[model samples]
Target: MSKLVNKSQCVVICCFPANYTVGLTTVVEALALGIPLICTKNVQMPMDIDHEHCGITVEPGDMGGWEKAVNYIAENPDVASDMGRRGRELAEKVYNLDNCAKDVSAVLKTLIKK
Candidate 1:
């Protein structure tokens, strides 16, 4: 697991179980460690993944689907690395206290403006 996390140019997450939010934490950890994500649409992962911008999603259980996703990410090292950097940026933007508060405040102010 650690090697995959360490040496992988990209990280592919295959999650298909119902209510499987378990992978989210690990995905976030990978992002924190600068790993790009190639995930499946299964278990709400497509929504979690940032589409082709930060991650690629493929239909679950398609033969070679996982490989395709990983290869796609691997083929474009620049895009993959940018996505990894963006993932960390997103985490900082959404998870940090100051950034979270600012985002919340902006949303609340927008609601009040209506």
Candidate 2:
């Protein structure tokens, strides 16, 4: 899954009707790989996908919106590439393991101090 996702141009996470917190790992992988995404809005991290223009989000169960978003990305290669670059930047700055560890350490230290 990781190799396939890393090699893909874009990833579509269609977690509709059953919103589990499953697709976030895929999302992070896609971000790290600089791939654009099309995802259901009910996923655990819609803000991360939408805020950075890393992808398009459609309401869960909205097939038409999904199709439109896919088509838009397909038709706009430049925009898609830019989104991918932004996603990579976001992944490095926010989602990298080093940053995550730092964040955790900070919280733990604060808790210990308190």
Candidate 3:
């Protein structure tokens, strides 16, 4: 999956609300691979893809919106590249394992002190 995503221009993760578990495995994978994303707004996401400037969201079941999104990425190379870069930066900030361990230890230490 990582290899495939690394080679992808962008990733589209369109799904219905409650169609499956709203895990961010695919999303984080795309971010880690530095690929821009087009996902459904139905997703129960932890972060704002739009606010993060990592991707755009489409209304669920909107075929025209999907078409527009793909065209936007294909036609706007600079913007797409920026989005991918931002995605990678966000993944590094939020998902780096070493940073995660440090954050967890801080919380644990605080609890221990309490």
Candidate 4:
């Protein structure tokens, strides 16, 4: 998943569970890899994906949103490219795998210490 985002030409991640919290991991990954993203509001995507600047947000299961998102990226190459760049930068700093590993390690260490 990370590698795809890192090397893919573009990405559109649609999530289920309307109330789910969207993880910005994929979006961030795509961004870091210079790939554009299209996400939905079903979950709270990390801050970067939340903003339309980094990607498009569609209402879950809404065909219109899907079309619009796709169209937006296809029609506006500059915006999409810029967004991919931003997403990549955000991912490198905030969603890096090392950062996630460190956070998980801290939680486990605390649990063991307890």
Best by lDDT: 3
Candidates ranked, most accurate by TM-score first? 3, 2, 4, 1
Q: Is candidate 2 or candidate 4 better by lDDT?
A: 2
Q: Write the per-residue lDDT of candidate 1 for residues 76-111, one digit (tens) a residue.
A: 889888988887776665545586578789999999
Taken over the whole model, the C-alpha lDDT of each candidate is 0.71, 0.84, 0.86, 0.72
Segments in model 4 whose C-alpha atoms lie over 4 Å from true places: 1-9, 18-25
Q: Candidate 3: global Cα-lDDT?
A: 0.86
TM-score of each: 0.68, 0.78, 0.79, 0.77
Question: What is the Å distance of residue 15 in model 1 from its true position?
Answer: 1.9
Residue-wise C-alpha lDDT for candidate 4, range 1-60, written one tens digit per residue: 566556554688877755556555566556667777787775444463656467777777
How far does residue 44 in candidate 1 sit from its true spot (Å)?
3.6
Inter-residue clash pairs, candidate 3: none
Better of 2 and 3 by lDDT: 3
Worst 10 residues of 3 by lDDT: 16-25
**What lDDT would candidate 4 get against the real structure?**
0.72
The residue-by-residue lDDT of candidate 2 on 1-114, one tens digit each, is 678777766899888555556588888888889999998786456355787899998888888998899999989989999999999999998899998799889999999998
